[model samples]
Target: MIFEGYHPLDKTMFQVMDEEGNIIKPEYMPDISKEQMMEMYQLMIQTREADLKALMYQRQGRMLTYAPNIGQEAAQVGSAFPLKKEDWMVPAFRELGAWLTRGAKLEMIYLYWYGNEFGSYMPEDLKILPVSVPIASHLNHAAGIAWASKLQGKDEVTITYFGDGATSQGDFHEAMNWAGVYQVPVVFLCQNNQFAISVPRGIQTSSETIAQKALAYGMPGILVDGNDIFAMYAAVKEAFDRARRGEGPTLIEAFTYRIGAHTTSDDPKRYRSDEEVEKWKKKDPIDRMKKYLMSQGILTEEENEKIIEKAGKIAEEAFKYVEASGDTVLEDIFKYHYKEMTPQLTEQLAEYKAYLMERGEA
Candidate 1:
C-alpha cells in the first residue's frame, strides 16, 4: 500500500468498527468465530473491572501503587492475542491487560505492585520481559531482541507498548532508527491516550500524530481506533504477519483516551475537567463491545453480571494470595542482581541483616 503525505492526519486511518456498535468496514473483519470474538470481549471487560478494583485496593492501602488501564483494554487485549508463544512482549507500566493476555498471572501482577521483586520475574518459557518503569528504555531492549532474532534466523518478533509521552524520549527515537536501519522484526505499539500525566498530547508535541513519526523510519505506520477491538486485532495481526514474513517493523498508534488518573498517585481533576471524563465514558471500550455482543444476542444482562462477579472473585483471590505471600525479604533485593551474590553485595546484605537483627526487625 502506498501511503501519501507525511502525517497520519492526512492519511487514511484504518478501523473495522464504529463507536455506535457497528462494523463499518466489513472487509477488514477478522476471520475468528463469533464465539471467539465474544470471548475476547468478555475477557477485555473482565480485565477492565479487575484493573479498576486493583486501583481501589491501592487507594484503600490494601495494595501497592497501581496503574489503571481503564480505557485501553481493547487495545491491550486485542493486540496481545495475535502474539505467538515464542515471541517476546515488553510492556510499560500501564499494560496489565496485555500482560494478562500474554499469560501473566494476576497474583504475580499484584505482587509486583506490592513491591515484590519476584513479581517482575516472568517464567523463561513465557518469553515476556520484566515490566519496565523507565518509560522508553524498553524500546531499546525490544529492538536488541529483534535484531538478535533476525541474526539467528529465528521466526520471532518483539512487540513493545509505550505511551504517547514516551514517544518524545531520546531512547524511543534511537530504537526506531536502529530498528529501521536493520529491518528488525519489531512492532512499536503506541497507545496515544492524549496525555502524558498532566501534559496533554497537544502540548507534548506539535507533530500531527504519533504514527506519523514512523514515516521517518521508513516503516508502515497505522492509526486505529484503540477502543474498537476489531480494529486493534486487525492492525496488530497485519503487523505481526509482516514481521514474520521478514518485512521488518511497523508502528501502530492506537488512538484512545485515558479516562482515569495516570496512576493511583495522580489526580486527573487537577489538570482535566470532569466534563471531559464523562464524555469519554460514553465512548467506553467495554460498553461498545457489550453493545455489539448484545446486538448479536451473544451477551445478556445476566451474562454480563456473571462475568463481572467472576472477575471480582478472581481479583479477590489474587489480593488474598498477595497478602498471604507476606512482605518481601530485605535480602531479596541483593539476591536477584546476579546468579550468585558478589562479595561486595554479600557484605552489604550481611551488614543490613546485622542492623535489622540489632533492632529486632530481621
Candidate 2:
C-alpha cells in the first residue's frame, strides 16, 4: 500500500528508488512493464541529447535565447509520459521536453526558439497551452481551465509546470486557493530545481519545503525525488488520478537540481560553486535511468549508442528545417492579438507598411 502521512505536512510522498539506484519500495511501483520502462529510458536519453544539441545551437547563434532543461529530464519526461492526450498541459519556459512529449513537433519548438510566434501553433484539438514565460501566471490559467472542465462535467484535467521561484508569487497562492475551493481537476507540478535564477531555494522562501506549502491550500502536496523517473512518474500519476476522481487539485514539488544556467542569458558560475554543480551531476537523471535500464538487462551498449545517434540526427534535421523557414513576416505580428485590429493598430500597421514601401523593403 502507498504510505500516507510520511511527511510532517501529512502529504503522501512515495519514492520507489533511492539516489544509490536501489529500489526501496517495490510494492508501490508502477504497473509498467520492463520493456516500457526501457523505452522511457531511451526517450529520456533522447530528450537529454536533444536538449544539449539545442543549447549548442543557441550558443552558435542559430536559435534564440533558450532555457536548458538538462538536469530536469526525469521530472519532465517521466511526469509527461503518463499524461493522456485529452489532458491539458501548461508549461513554463523550461519545459521543451514535456512539450515534445505532449505532441508538440520538434520543428515547431525549434521555430519557437528561432523567434517565430507561429511556433506556438499546435493542432486544433491538442490540449496544450502556449508557453508561459511570465513565471507563475499560468498556474491561474490552469486552475481556471480545470474549474471550467469541472463545471462542464468534463473529465479532462490540466497540469501546470513551474519552478521553485514561482511558488513565491501571489498568483501561485491564489490559483491554489481557487483550485482547492472549487475542487478543480488540476495538478500543480512544481519542478523545484533548487534555484530561481541566481537565488537559491533557501533565499526564495522561509518554508521548510515547497510541498508543505500546499497544506494551507487544503490539498495533497507530494514531494518526490525529481531525479528518479519512477518517483516522478508515480507522484504525477497519483495526482492525476486524484484530480480525475474529483478529489480537487494536487500540488507536486519535484525536488531536482538545475544543472546549467537559468537560461542562455544568465550564468550560474558567477553565483554558485562548481562543487555544487558537480554534486548534482552525480545524480544525473539520464545517467540514473540508463543505469536502471542496464541493470534490468533491457538496454545494451550498441542499442544505446544507436538511440543517441538517431536523436542527434533528428535534432540536426529540425535545426535545418527551422533555419530554412526564414524570418517572421511583419504582417504576421498583426494577425494573432485580435480578430479585428483596432483603429490605432490599423493606423500603426499602415504607417509601418508605408515606411517599408518607402524603403523598398516591403
Candidate 3:
C-alpha cells in the first residue's frame, strides 16, 4: 500500500474493478453474503429510480428542492452497508443511498423534499442525523458527537458524509484538526464527484487530493475509485474498523463523478460537457456491479428486470405517499422553530392566523 512519487495522492487512486467489469483484485472484494450483495445492488437501483422520480416531482413543482446522487451510488451504499446499527451516520444533502440503507423511510425522504420538516425526523433507534444542507458545517457536529461517544466509553463509530466541495470549507479543517487531537472515533467520507456546482475540483483547492489533507491532521487517508463499489466498501470498512479499535479518524476520498446537476435548481450543462458526462456514465457504479453479478451467474436478465420493476414500484409508492401527505402546515413552522416561542413571535403567529381566518384560508 505504498504510494510513490512527488505527489503520492496522484498515485493512490485505488480500484478493485476495472472499467470493463473485470475485477482487478479479487481479494479486495467486500466480505458480504451473496444475499447481502444482491440487496445492495437492488438498493442501488432503487436509489437511482427514486432520484429520477424526485427530479420529475421537481419539474412538476411538487417538490421544493432536491440534491440528486444519481451516479454516486457505490460511494454511498458501499460505505453505509458496513456500519453496525449502533453506529452513527451524519449525512450531507446528497446521501440518499446512505440514508435509505441506514433505515430511513422513502416516504419521509420525499416528504422532506416536498417542504415538510417532519421528514427530517428519524426513528429513535436509528442513529442517522437529519441531512445538513450547508456544505461542511456538520463535520464539526460529527466530530463533537464522536468525541462525546469516546468520553462515554461507547463502542460506536461516527461516520459523516459530504461532497468534494465540502473539503474546501473551513469547518472541514477544524473538524479534522479536533478529531485528530482528541483521536475521535469518526470516519470522514468525502464523495469527490469532481465538481462543486460550476466550480471544478482543481479550482477548489491546490492539494492534489482531498485524502492528502488528512496527513496534515495526523490521520491516515485513502483514495479509492468511487465507481468501484468493492473498493469503496473495503476502504470504508477498514477505516471504521480502525476507528472502533481506538485508532484516530480516517479521511477517505471517494473519487467519483456527478453525472447530474448539483440539484434541480442547477444546470450542469452550462459548465460541463455532455462528453464528460458520457465518459462517467460508462464507468457507472451500479452498472459495473450488475455486470459483475451477471458474470458470476448470480444475476440473470429476468432477475435484473424484476429488480428494476421493484425499484420503480417503490419509487412510485413513495411519490404517492408524499403527494397524499398534502402541503406543510404553515403554523407548524412556528411551533417547531423553538421549544418556547418569544412573546414577539407568538404575537406574529396570532396575527398570521388572524389574517388567514379573515381570508377563509385557514
Candidate 4:
C-alpha cells in the first residue's frame, strides 16, 4: 500500500510523476487506459474553465461569494475519479472539481453561488453533500454517515475534503478519534493547499505533516504529490480499496498549492509573495497532465484547444442558465429551516418583505 511505504512521520512524499510530466513511479501508476486518462484531463480542463468563469461572474457582482478551486484541480479530480456511484462525497466549499466528478451539474453550482437554495438540490444517484463552509465540522458528519452505513451493512464509503487549517479544529480530532474507534469506512483527504485563507500552514500545527495525525488515531496516512494526478489517483484508490476491505479509514494529505485567492472575497497578495506564487506555478497540475497526455499521443495541440473552447462554452452556457433562472422566492429563505415558520421567523419575514417593498424590491 502507498500508506505503508510513505510514512507520514518520515515526511517523505509519494510521487508518480515529476513536474515535467514524466512518470517517475510507473509501478505505482494507476492502470487506467489512455483514453480514460485523457477524459480525466479533459474533466480538469472543464473544471478550470468553470472556476475561471465563476470568478468573473463574482467580480461582476452577478454571483455571490464563491470558493475558487484553481490550482487544486488534480487533487480534487484524481481522488474523486475513483469513487463509484454509490460512494458518498462530502465536500468543503472549494471542491468544484470533485463535485463535477461526482455528477454535479455546472448550472447547480452556479445557482448556488447565485444565491438560490435549489443549488443544493442534487440528483438521486449522487450522494454528495452540499458545500460545507464551517471548516472541519463536516468531517463529523462524514463519520456519522459511514457509521450508519456500516450498521446497515451497506457497501458505502465516504470521502471528505478539507483544508490544512481545518486540521487545527477540535472537530477534526473528535471525528478522527471516533472513526478510529469504530473502524468506519471513510477517507480523510486534506488538500493542504499551503494556506488556509492567508494563514500559512507552518503556524496551523506543530506537527510536521497533517497525515501523521492519523497515526495517533490508529489509521494509516500518506502524503502524496497533489500536483501529480497519477499519485493522487493511485493513493486515493488504494485508500478506498482498504476501506472496502474493512481495513477502516485512511488519511491522505495532498500537498498542493492554491494558485488563486481562497475565495472571491480574498486577496492573496496581502499575505503571500509573488515569488512564492510564481515558484508554485511551475508545478501547475493541469499543465503537467496536458504534457503527459500530449506526449502519449492522446491529445494534440488542436485537440486540446477544442477541449478548452468547448469547456469554455459549456461554462458560459451554465452560468447563462443560472442567470436566466429568475430570482429566488422571498419565502424560500425563511421556510426551509422548519416544518412551518416559527412565530419569530414569520414576523421577521414580514418585516423583511415590508422593507423590500419600500425599496421596490419585493
Scored by lDDT, model 4 comes in at: 0.92
- List, in order, the clash count of every candidate structure: 0, 0, 0, 0
- Residues 76-140 of candidate 3: C-alpha lDDT, one tens digit per residue: 99989899988999998899999889989899999899989988889978989987989999999
Q: Give all TM-scores, in the order shown.
A: 0.96, 0.95, 0.96, 0.96
Instruction: Give one digit per residue, the lDDT tens place, for model 2 in 99-141.
Output: 7677788888878888998887788677888878997999999
Worst 10 residues of 1 by lDDT: 1-10
Candidate 3 vs candidate 4: the lDDT winner is: 4
> Per-residue alpha-carbon lDDT of model 4 for 9-34, expressed as tens digits?
99999999999989988889899999
Worst 10 residues of 3 by lDDT: 1-10
What lDDT score belongs to each candidate, Candidate 1 first?
0.87, 0.85, 0.88, 0.92
Ranking by lDDT: 4, 3, 1, 2
In terms of TM-score, which candidate is stronger, 3 or 4? 4
Error of 4 at 209 (Å): 0.7
Q: How many residue pairs clash in model 3? A: 0
* Model 1: residue 293 alpha-carbon error in angstroms: 1.1
- Report the lDDT tens digits of candidate 1 across residue range 1-362: 32232247675677777888888988788888888887787678768878877888888898777888999999998899888898999888889878888888888888998889899888888899888998799999999999999999999999999999999899999999999999999999999999999999998988878888898998888788899988898888888988999999999999999988898889899999999989988888888988888898988999889988888899888889988984887879999889999999999999998999999988
The residue pairs in collision within model 2 are none
**TM-score, cand. 2 vs. native:** 0.95
